[model samples]
Target: MPAKTKEQKTAACMALAMKRGDLKKTPGTPAGDMAESMTEEQLVELCGSKVKKGG
Candidate 1:
């Protein structure tokens, strides 16, 4: 199932970001560059607010 909640959306986006190397791992932080600079639009684009039905 596609992500539906804010938490799920964020997790999905973070996973995608990691897979695409858009987000890096820092020694002390859970995320790197993308997290530090990511905008709301970027997150929404990465993980859509709603999943397309039967598509």
Candidate 2:
């Protein structure tokens, strides 16, 4: 089996959380977590408005 990347692991964690109803969308907090300020900037810099194959 192929090793799971961090993105893949995070996706699986999110999926499991949703499956168990652990990831709820709080009305007051739009962040819904799933995001970090620094990481978001890094991702944007890396991807740069281009749609990659896997993304």
Predictions in order: lDDT: 0.56, 0.38
TM-scores of the models, in the order given: 0.42, 0.36
Candidate 2 deviant stretches above 4 angstroms? 1-3, 25-55
Tens-place lDDT digits, model 1, residues 11-33? 65774576466766453343344
Question: What lDDT tens digits, residue by residue, belong to model 2 across residues 1-55?
Answer: 2213555444434434443466763333323343322244433333243323452
Best by lDDT: 1
By TM-score, who's the top model here? 1
lDDT of 1 at 9: 65
Give the local distance difference test score of model 1: 0.56
Candidate 1, RMSD to the unseen true structure: 8.2
